[model samples]
Target: MNLLDENNRHPTAITDNSAYDGEPTWSPDGRWLAFASNRTGSGEIYITPLEGGVARQITHHPAWDENPSWSPDRDNPRIAFVSSRDGHFAVYVIDLAFVPGAGLPAERRVSPLEYTAFDPSWSADGRTLIFAASLRGHSEIYAIDIDAAPSADGYAMRPLTDGLIDRQQPAWWP
Candidate 1:
């Protein structure tokens, strides 16, 4: 991790290791950073204080877990990321509050199991997630209510944009 100063000069290296870290997202308060790294051989999510500290591993799965999106809600801190832990790529949430030597909190599958989902962006309220998913060979933008009960098909995802176009990342307009 590197921090670029106000003048865009030489970025001060926040991390000085050979671990391939990517997709860094700052917390709502800007006190910490959540990102994915291959330091442990496989992709895993990790959290580190922006002020300089040890990066703590958040996800402990053998499969690839990357693309972390920090929740906007600080009261119920969580991170939404894409993981292939369940056989295929899908959106999953990691509760930060419960991750101190307690293994991982219950895995919360945010995206539908039937689709290959990626790039999860949280709503302002942190109650919803918007991501790109490919189902039936078509890529589309989907918004899912994280707390809503699953439908008969096991997912309550609503499509926001649909087409044959290759849509990968969908972010909410500020």
Candidate 2:
């Protein structure tokens, strides 16, 4: 991964090591960058400081975990990502405020396992997340309120776009 200036000149390498590193997402404070990498085998979430340092692996699962979207709130640091740990693609959120002694952070599946959700984007307030998912035989954008506790089935999600056309990679304005 590389960082480029506003002018798109003098791009600096962020991850110099050899690995499939991509899908970089900057932290709310811009001090750290969260991205997906296959350094340790399957794709997993990793965080590297912008000031330069060794990248820390945040997620450890046999399945693939990619497409990280950091919460916009600095006080409540969280990362919404796409994971296939449950046998199906789904959106999961990890609370970055807590660091466990071992294993990955406690993940909350924001999207149901039945649907394939990816390309998660966070709302400006960090209270909601928008992503693309396959529902009703078509791919469409959806938004879910992450501020509330997950219901019995999972986090409540609603379609943002009609099923008339396929949509992917929903981005929210800063």
Candidate 3:
């Protein structure tokens, strides 16, 4: 991926690898970037310092994990991403504050198992996540309260738009 200035000039390569890396999201502090890369063969979440260095793999899964969205809260540097590890696309959140190899930080599945959720964006307060999902034969936007405890099936989710037209990518305003 390339980073460009406000004028869309002087684009600099953020990830100049040949690993099909895309969907980059900047952290709240703008010091780091979180993106999805297939460098390890399967798509996994990776974080790299904006200054430059080796990118660290966050999610080491065989299934595709893409569309990473960093929380807006600087204190809670958590990442919300889409993963297909459960045989279906779902939204998951991981705490970046936790050490990488520390017994695998608790991964919370924010979306339910029945739906295909993707392109997650965090609320301004970082307490909710908004994403697009296939529901009732059409794509729609849904919001879930991640701060609340999820039930056995998943977290409490609500649709934001009617299932009239397809809505793929959702961007939450600050």
- Using alpha carbons, what is the TM-score of model 3? 0.88
Model 3 over residues 1-174: C-alpha lDDT tens digits?
888887868988888888898888889989899999998899999999999898889898899999899999888789999999999999999987776566565577888788889889888999888999994677899898887876566568888888588998988765
Better of 1 and 2 by TM-score: 1
Candidates in order have lDDT scores of 0.88, 0.88, 0.87
For each candidate in turn, the TM-score is 0.91, 0.90, 0.88
| Order of quality (TM-score) | 1, 2, 3
Error of 2 at 125 (Å): 0.7
Q: What is the lDDT of residue 73 in candidate 1?
A: 90
Deviation of model 3 at 68, angstroms: 0.7
**What shift in Å separates residue 88 of candidate 2 from its native position after superposition?**
1.5
In angstroms, the error of model 2 at 73 is 0.6
lDDT tens digits by residue: candidate 2, 52-162: 899998888899999999999889899999999999899999998876776557678888878988889988999989999995677999899987766667667887888
